[model samples]
Target: MAVGVSGDDLMVRVGPDATDEVLGRPGARIFDMTGRPIRGWVVVAGSAVTEDEALGEWIDEGHAFAASLPPK
Candidate 1:
């Protein structure tokens, strides 16, 4: 549950605690599939992740956040 692809956007599981900061990043926005925005997730514009390093960074953030959560 680290990252996902939604159309052309990159979905990141950044956790609710970091939602505001993540959203403040360029091309970042709350992920919304059914009108309501999902907590702990964000959709980054495809254009923002053109660089491999940038993409990796986002995925790392997502992975880190996911790791912080308790296992089901």
Candidate 2:
């Protein structure tokens, strides 16, 4: 899990266990809120993956994914 200031108005929180991983190797998946990957074509071919970070690209990806999920 990771947390940091996104900007003057937002604080981004990224957690590996935040989302669900549907693809990739064991324990290597795209997360949502339950540390799992999404059901989409976003997962790449490799087992390694990366996401957004505090107002950056990675952060954007994480935010979008988070928003798509239902409140849990």
Give a tens-digit lDDT track for model 2, residues 1-59: 22233222222333344334423332223323456644432322222223233235434
TM-score of 1: 0.93
Which runs in model 1 stand beyond 4 Å of their true positions? Answer: none
After superposing all C-alphas onto the true structure, candidate 1 shows an RMSD in angstroms of: 0.8
| Clash count list over all predictions | 0, 20
For each candidate in turn, the TM-score is: 0.93, 0.27
* Candidate 2 whole-model C-alpha lDDT, 0 to 1: 0.37
**lDDT for predicted candidate 1 compared with the true structure:** 0.93
